[model samples]
Target: MDQYAVFGNPISHSKSPAIHTMFAKQTQQAMEYGVIEAPLDGFEKAVGEFIHRGGQGANVTLPFKQQAFALADQLSEAARLAEAVNTLSFNKGRIYGDNTDGKGLVADLKLQGVTLTDARILLLGAGGAARGVIAPLLSELPASIHVANRTEQRAVELAVQNPSSKLVASGLDNIEGEFDLVINASSASLAGSVPSIRGPLVADAVCYDMVYAATVTPFNLWARQQGASRTIDGLGMLVCQAAESFAIWRGVRPDVNPVMQFLRAQMTQSL
Candidate 1:
């Protein structure tokens, strides 16, 4: 069996193993997926050991994504643009890296019937999560994207990294105008809080939170309270991105709907 795993610092809570297992079963691929909790300072060593043990590929999470980018022998355009690598493949002596998060986000938005063409977008936060999805979002020809962060400089830096006339930057407090879509990529949702932005930004907009929980995420719930047209959590993005990584390793795509349904049921039951 081909061996694969997701690597991170605190990896016990990851759902990647279950998601990939379902993908493997659905695609009839003979592979094993698991998790590796690498020490903060020992990431490279851990990856080397996995490769030595015949590991085929691995998914990276959190702090390790940037490290994986530096370790790759070759990088896909998405990974290069994102400056992070969430998916990795090993063949012979070469390690190939790619970032599937943006593709996954765009795919999920399309699946949910959210229009991206020529829409005004508000992206909250300028962290890695925000960076990974900007390119894909821009590809859809959105009329404009305003990136807002607590630290205005960081958001401005992110906009400069991906220079486009359609993109702009601002501090959260300085955010202006209503958006057709509001995407929460900040860590506020993880703390059960919503980003500090005006309610009108989300009103009548499609609100998406890049954080998932058993119930609606804090950001999504807050968006709904502000009369958002629709609200979605990140579970679909997680599944879709994992499917992208699986396809990279197996050369076959697995149906995501059934897997998403199964995971949703599990989340509800746990609640």
Candidate 2:
């Protein structure tokens, strides 16, 4: 089997192995996927060892995506804009990096029947997760994109880095207007917290939380309570992004719908 794995500091909870294993089986590809827990400070060493062991590709998660970006021999355009890498393809001693998170999120949103064209978007958080999605979202030609963060300056910096006449930044508490779409890319949801943005969300707005759990995320729950027309979790994005990485490694794209259905059933069973 061609070896592949996902590398992260706290990796035991990752679903990449199961997701990629299913992709391999369905595509009739001879590959093995697993998880590698790199020590917090040992990401480079861990990647080196994986390469030495003939690992052909890997997914990167949390606290290490930026480091993986730095380690890449070359980067896809999305990775270059995001300045973060979630997928790495090892080719003849060269490591190529790409960011599939934004692609996945956009794909999932389209699947959910959310339109991005000329939409007003509110992105919550100024972290790497938020950064990873901005470029892809911009490609959709949204009317405007407002980034809100607890630390106002970080939001300003991120917007400046990806300057756009349509893009603006604000403190979460001072979010001035409603939006057609609201995306939660903050770690706040992982901590069971919501971004400090209070609303009047746009009429019939769609809300998305990039963090997923067995139940609705705190952010999504709050959005629903605030009358969002629809709320989506991160599971679909996760599956779609993994499919993109699979394609990157195996040169074939697996159907994401079946994998998403299977994963949802699995999550339900576990709950």
Best by TM-score: 1
Clashing pairs in 2: none
Q: How many collisions per candidate?
A: 0, 0
Give model 2's TM-score versus the native structure.
Answer: 0.97
Name the runs in model 2 displaced over 4 angstroms: none
Residue range 1-271, candidate 1, lDDT tens digits: 8999999989999999999999998888999999999999999899999999999999999889999999999999999989999999999989999999999999889888999999999999999999999999999999999999999999999999999999999999999988999999997877888889988888999999989888988888889999999999999999999999998999898999998899999999997
lDDT of each: 0.94, 0.92
Tell me the RMSD of model 2 versus the true structure: 1.2
Identify the runs in model 1 with alpha carbons over 4 angstroms from their true place.
none
In candidate 2, what are the lDDT values of residues 87-194, reduced to their tens digit? 999999999999999999999999888999999999999998998999999999999999999999999999998989989999888888778999999879878998
